[model samples]
Target: MSKKVENLLRDICFRIKVKGREVLKEFPITPAQFDLMQKLYFAGEQTMTELSRMLGIAKSTTTGLVSRLENEGFVERKRRKNDKRIIIVVLTKKGEYVIDKVIFKRIEFVEEVLKDFDNNSKEVLVSLLEKLNNSVKRRGG
Candidate 1:
């Protein structure tokens, strides 16, 4: 039963990723860049080192990603006011707009897929997923 549940979750995740990539096709940024933007969008501004650590990538790689995002006007690097040496990456309005649209599209896809599910069923599913998510977090996953 656990194995079946794992497989189903994996398959569902894969399908969602495929759909996300399809939605990303309309954007100018690559998936990796979009991921970086998402990190910033949710976590607020972060220093270059912090971004690299959070993304689990090398500083040089993070720099390159930041460069591209900066060039595209999706993000900007700002020097800390007190600590002028530290530079933080900030998401621009353009970046926020892209993130919003991408999330909206993904939600629309999910809505279409769940169109046939009754309200009670949908609520139950959400509750189960939330419980699963909490369990995973407790396990440090």
Candidate 2:
């Protein structure tokens, strides 16, 4: 039972990721950029080091990503007032706009996917997913 549940979860996660990538193709940013931007959007402004650590990428890679985002007007970097060396990356208004649109589209897609499910089923699914998420977080994922 555990193995089957694990396999199902893995497949669902993979399918969701693939679908997300397909949907993002209509947007201006790549998957990596979208991921970074999403993190910044939810987590607020963060230093390059913090972003790199959060994304599990190298500092140089984060720098390049930030540079591209800055050039595209999706993000901006500013030096900390107390320390000129620390650079914080923040999402711009344009970035916020893009994220909002992308998220709305994604939600719409999910709603379509779950359209067949009744309200009670959706409520149960939401509860179970939330429980699973909380468990994963508690385990320090």
Best by lDDT: 1
| Alpha carbon lDDT at 77, candidate 1 | 97
> Per-residue CA lDDT of candidate 1, range 14-118, in tens?
787667667677767988898899999999999989999999999999999999999989999999999999899999999998888877877888999999899
Q: Model 1: runs farther than 4 Å from truth?
A: none
TM-score of each: 0.90, 0.85
Tens digits of per-residue lDDT for model 2, 1-141 = 989989999987676666656656666687889889999999999999999999999999999999998999999999988999988999999888878877776677788889999999999999999998899999998
| Cα RMSD for candidates in order | 1.6, 2.0
Following a full C-alpha superposition, what root-mean-square deviation does model 1 have from the true structure?
Answer: 1.6
